[model samples]
Target: MRPAIIRKPAEQSVTPNWDDSAAARAAFSWQAQAGELCGLPGGGLNLAYEAVDRHAQGRRRQHVALRLLDRNGGRCDISYARLSSLSNRFANVLKGLGVQPGERLFVLCGRGLELYLGVLGGLKLGCVVCPLFSAFGPEPIETRLRIGEGSVLLTSEALYRRKVAGIRERLPQLRQVLLYEDNGGAVDTPPGTLSLAQLLAEASDDFAITPTTADTPALLHFTSGTTGTPKGALHVHGAALTHLVTGKYALDLHPDDIYWCSADPGWVTGTSYGILAPLLLGVTSVVDSGEFDAERWYSILETQGVSVWYTAPTAIRMLMKAGAELARRHRFPRLRFIASVGEPLNPEAVWWGQDVLGLPIHDNWWQTETGGIMLANTLAMPIKPGSMGKPLPGVEAAIVSRDEQGGLILLGDETVGELALKQPWPALFRGYLGQEERYRRCFVGDWYLSGDLARRDADGYYWFVGRSDDVIKSAGHLIGPFEVESALLEHPAVAEAAVIGLPDALLGETVKAFVSLKSGIEPSAALHDELLGHGRKRLGAAVAPKALAFLPDLPRTRSGKLMRRLLKARELGLPEGDTSTLENPR
Candidate 1:
């Protein structure tokens, strides 16, 4: 089948923030975007002020900033004014506790008012805010805190008792442990922890933000490697520009749009788009405090009246597995634009969104290191189902392979190579914490090597191949697992697929795929051969999978990326390093 092109010229009525792609790229500048944010009172830039304080002090003061939903069908709305005041009080609380500027303040909590206030307040106080997922076990939590040298921690009372209490003595640098109030009501505070509610209540909400420059270390997000300790990616306050610009151009966020980014702040997507971008754009963002249920998600879209939604491919696949009949049960008339990240979305999921949900799901590409969206199938552009659309305005991406002298040899259109970004982009990570040499290896001269394999078409659309390390070298042919996986996904029986290369006598690496079937589809000899033959027919003999196996589910990271390396390691009796981020590893 020829690649599907989804163009929704009449999909939306409102004029997008960017309409003319060519003109937007030609007339874009980071300096011009700087003027969009309201900096501090004097001569400095602060993310918190731009995201909440500026709006609270202006006409959108009473506008809903965060619409928080609890697991048990509860709703709470916090206006910008309320957000600013509460964050101000928390900032004062941080100040009173002697947490100074540039100090690392780690937040470990779930979706609620405290998570929002903790991040914004830490930014307001000029501290480098680092947020950890509340679902993380104690070891991963302790590792990040120790690596980042966390001085203050804000978490829930239950989370503290469960995950943090055991690791408290292990982290001497964590001097201040703050516990926030949860919906379950107050419990006795731990011995070393302070109650965030009591602290906020006593603290004054009239604190002023100290002046800070654009280079001020504002946020720290830890990214773990497959075989080592997690590396902290340090981002500055200036990264807010990337978030703002990408939200406008890539996500098409407008002030009146009710947006929902179904990602947790533990991952970069949740922090960048879910929190900063939407807030900086002055849009009402919905935060759901429950785990992913297909029915609940559809309900949220309908009831919340969400206009813009940014989610992940894993979530989309799960929804696809839930069947279209369940989707038709709910209506999402308000949903105008939908985008997916965290992985290369399979084309089937994109078409499923169009056929069932009334809109095609746009796919975008970026990484933890890049910090913001580099490529996207934007609202104004025609969606090439599996393509990562085109480069964002002001972003220059190239397909390049390394030369013998360790220099970049730029490849032409339709050539698969490492995706390189010519940078000076605001959202690029400044450095990996305590790993300067490792950080330096990520770039060659001016281009940041993304380690992702991709091909650029003549029309400037980018299609993801696979990770450089994950690419299979089989019989002198370099094959991308994504292509094989995508082809497998087109089959009616396949729900999810992960392709890997295994050692073989004839070929250096042979393609092997592990798959999960749709609901009520069982794995048998006949079905297995049919799927294998389907891959061979679609992808051809050389690129197709020679071996196939059925799995109950595919393994993925906590952030929803398929962990192909883990699958390979388990299959080959290799060490499965750092299974902490794996979701319920066997």
Candidate 2:
């Protein structure tokens, strides 16, 4: 929120080309060069080739493409050459199965090498790739299959049985199902399923990459809607280029940096950071295939020599509770930066990270519609606590007016309102697939209105308040959930907390909190009253929770977003839909 901090000297080494905006824009992506910027191109460049083949052609094949650690603790170091060949073989497998270009290929695998290849392979074949979380159950999986109209489903043998087995009969468009893991005992494959290994063995590992434009549909990411069905967010090849640019600035990922982004690949963060950004830049990124353990995560940094580390605020908070001494023994001399997305990184977490991790944690913000990071604190920029920093160079972010009609209107400086983008960048989604009306509603005139509420200081730094839906209203006064949650987090006993609005006959809706206590803390009536008293003293009674439920954990998305809607649904005894994204729904 202060005056713009001058770029640090070290930041210059990782800066993107700013020579000619016209030339940089011209070289945005294959789709832009192919004429998709003005109108749809007849042929487009494949993003897979752009990320893999283009790097290979430029003699960057020797660079480490991926450093993968399996669930069983096995390690695999893959280069550009290996990644390209693997993708080719996978593309050939799809080709042999009669899967044509422009068809849909759905991938349902966890973090690892196979998931990477399947995604790139589908893109190389000019097919739309839909990546789903491995934790999703049959209902969520079925919803995607119905909407995606997937021609082929690729998954590990474990997830295939646990999730897809029961729903395979209902998916009419799913022609082929390929299992990546080698299961000696064959499970039922619905008559059309085939062995993925066998198919790849029969096909040549030299499938030709398809040529396309930047506008070609490369990805179909589904976002959960408050209404009926989930909407499919359509992204083109041009949007993929943003990852390469974002990686350099936001994440500070370099060739020697053993970067690790804790975000799962199923979410937008995973797609952007976990895969595309690192690969495009030829960085040696670490893939932690196992579960999250405070000691183990610290060990990975110490042992693997992770230079740039990125994770969520929730994980950082969890690590904070594990104490500083657990990491004191390790020497992470190579570690340079720490970054977070998912939610606003609390100032406390940022301070603790600097005190213990030797670097300040930078917070960034973006959405599913934006293919890459829009607002961020770059390595070159000076640290600003509790701010989402300025809009990235190519992005134009602004604060607009919230009118009486409950719609976004244009606003000037220092005013709090809805955040909107003045122009669509290369990474921005074209539209919601098959929902023209809904897509049209997202844009207000020239501005693309993001549903988040924020305020910009006189210096242009954007400060996040909360999501519009999560805003609390009481007695004609408006309050943000972050303000209240941040207050609650200050209490030593409160490990985590989520605030939501509940129906109140007197005040339309009153604030209610579901709290999780720190380790060894018990739920006591005295403690509840103490927390309420603390809230009254710290944040005023107007923002205090009217009712509090001490829970073990909050229902959150895999990306670590508190799912207040799900909690509200449960409190009202309403049927909760597609909690597939929920990490701990109970």
Candidate 3:
């Protein structure tokens, strides 16, 4: 297929904050941009100071920093100044509890004002903060807490009782457990827990930001392994620099923009973009404390006047399943750009946004290890459907293959190989927690080998192939599962699909597809044959699925990523290892 570009109109062209496209050809300097981000006067760089206190103390004090939409149809606004005061009080509470700097603090709660307060306060106090998915099971939560060596836990009474109570004995290093009422109201603590509300009330409302260098460890995010326990990726406060730059260039956040990043704060995207990026840009961020509802999301976008939306492809697919007529009921005059992460956005979803919502969805790529967006379809650039666009400024990306002697050989354009990046990015994770040898395996000399297989086009745009392990080698040809899955999704009946390579006797491997049909679509022999034929016609017979199976629902992570490895395991009746991160384990 030829490259399809969605160009920006004259009137719709946005003035990007970092509009120097020529910078890509120059020697990018991290210090030049690092100097732009506000740091503490004397010395050191603090994430909290740049995110909240600076805006609070400056002219934007009265600006609406956070607009909270409650589950029961209530709205509350928090200004930068008020947020500063509240986070300061929370920091004082931590100080009064004798929690020292560099100690790990874990938060387990749903989307609410308290989660933001806890995170910002922990950063202000210079503690390594880790947010756990509130929906996680007890064992998963316990494993993270134990591995991170968390000393203090801030959670609600309900969550603590349900998920943490049984495993509390196992976490002996966890010295303090602060419990808050789930409804954002004051409540008495249980026998072993302390009341967070009471402590906040007793503590002072003013506290100075901790003096910390850029290298100070600020966040700990755990990435689930395919077989073993999750690996903790440690990131530092300097990552704020990446967040700031990406927010401006990739997200195109303006000062008056109303941004909504519909990712949970527990994930890296949720923390970096959902909370920190918008705050760092001094924009109004909409924080919805409700679950995913098609009507509710439309209403929020229309009523809140969302200008820039950062969400997942899973949500977009759900919206597509609901039909475009449902979206016609709402009007979004203020909405400009819609961006997606978590997984690759299929070309159909990108066109669906332009056809239904009057905008093309811009897809970006990054990982938990990268800490921020590495490649993105910037607002200023033309949108290439199904492409990850180009690398951000100051990011040097290449496609390289490994030689027999473990040396990296740079591949030319249109050649599929490992996607590698030049090292020492501001947002790169310092190391995998307590696994020095494992961290060493991620790098090859000056390049960090991203485990993804991709191809760079002649125009500098990068296209995602598949995970290195997920690529299929059949009949001496390599086939990317994404291309097959995307072609399947182009069919009207297929709402979701996962492609995997199954072992074959004649060929090395054969492509197999697991598909979930859209609503009102029924499974039948005729329909199955029709889908198989559709796949054969769209993707060539050589790359098309050799077999097709219909599933009620595909397994996904909490962050809305398909578990292809799980699909392959179930098909072969192999042992399903590490099912902790699965949203729906079958």
Candidate 4:
């Protein structure tokens, strides 16, 4: 397929906030950009102080910071001044509980006012705030709590009973569990837990933000491994600089823009963008405390006047499955920008956004270790559908292969190799918790090995191939599963697809795809042959799937990422390690 270019109209194009490539290199190096982010008056820097308190004390105090939508179709607006007082009170509550600085504070609750207060408050108190998915089962919850050695946990009564109560006894380091009543603060607390509302009532609404250096750790995010325990990526307060820059240029955020990031705070994107980025940029963010519903999402986008939307590819594909006619029922006259992360966005989704949503879905790439957006299709640039655009101003990206001496050998453009970045970026993770050697192995001299296979086009756009481990070697050809999957999705009947490599005596490994069809489409022998022919026509016999299986649904993470590794493990009858993050574990 030819590259699909989505060009911005002259009137709609935004003037990028950051300096141009040449000017940026001359004026603002990574260190120079780091100096621009807000620091405390005395000396040190703090994430909460920069995100909330500063805005509260400034002219934007009356500006709405958060617009929270409840399940009952009600709304609550929180201003910077009000949020500042609330977070200050929550910080005071932490102090009253004898929770010291540098302690781990984990939040296991849905999106709500309390969740926001807890996160900002924990950061203000200098605690390492970690947010877990509310849907995680007991085992995953226990593993994170154990690894993080959580000193405090904030949750609702319902989540506590369903997920955390059974594992509470095993977490010896957990000092307290603060429960928020679900029934409008009318419920009684369980024997071992304390009431969060009552504590807040007793606490004063004034507390000083902790003075900390840019290097002080502020967040602990746990990322799943295919094997072994989850790795905890530690990030510092200085990451705010990366968040500010990326939010400004990549998302095209403006002070008057009303933005919505549909990612849950449990994941890294949710925390980095959903909470930190929008707030740091001083934009009004809409937060929905509900699950994925096509109608509800469109309603939020339409009614809230959301100008910029950052979401996942899975959610976008799900919306595509619902048909474009459903989206035509509403109008978003104010919406101007759409961006996707968490996984690579297929080319079809990008065109769908342009056709249905009146904009192209700009795809960006980053990782848990990177902590913020490293590469993106910024607002000022023309987007090549399915391409992760050029690296951000301060980010230096390269495609490199391993040398015989275990050092990195940079590859030229249009060559497929491991994607590596020259580090010292502000948002880079400090280290994996207690895994010094494991963390050190991620770097080769000055380059941080991304462990992703990609190629840079002659035009400078970066295209995602597949995970290094997911590359299939077949008949002297290295095939990326994403290419095969993208080809399969181009078929009209296909709704979702996952590709893997199966052992073959002749080719060493052959491509196999598991696909789910669109609604009202029946699986027939003719349709199967048609899909096979489509793949062959698009990708050729060397890279096309040799076999295809139809399924009702594909296993994905809660964050909407397809589990290709799990599919392969199940097909080969191998042990499926760490099924904790699987959306549907069977």
TM-scores, one per candidate: 0.99, 0.90, 0.98, 0.98
lDDT of each: 0.91, 0.78, 0.91, 0.90
Task: Give lDDT for model 3.
Answer: 0.91
- Model 1 Cα lDDT, one tens digit per residue, 1-586: 5466556556576887877456667888889988898778897899999999999999999999999999999999999999999999999999999999999999898988889989999999999999888899999999899999999999998899889999899999989988876875665787988888888889998878978888989999987546688889999998989999999999999889999999999788999998999999999999999999999999999999999999999999999999999999998888999999999998888889888898889999998889899999988877888898899988999999998999999999999999999988988999999999999999999999998999999989999999989999999999999999999999999999999999999999999999999999999999999999999999899999999999998888888888999999999999888877877577
- Candidate 4: clashing pairs of residues: none
Candidate 3, residues 418-535: lDDT per residue as tens digits? 9999988888999988899999999999999999999999989999999998999999889998999999999899999999999998899999999999999999999899989999
Comparison by lDDT, 2 against 3, better one: 3
Q: What tens-digit string does per-residue lDDT give for candidate 2 at 408-485? A: 676777666888886667778888867999899888767888888888887677888778887878877677777677
Tell me the deviation in Å of residue 238 in model 4. Answer: 0.8
- Give the C-alpha miss distance for residue 423 in model 1, angstroms: 1.3
TM-score of candidate 3 relative to the true fold: 0.98
Error of 3 at 189 (Å): 1.7
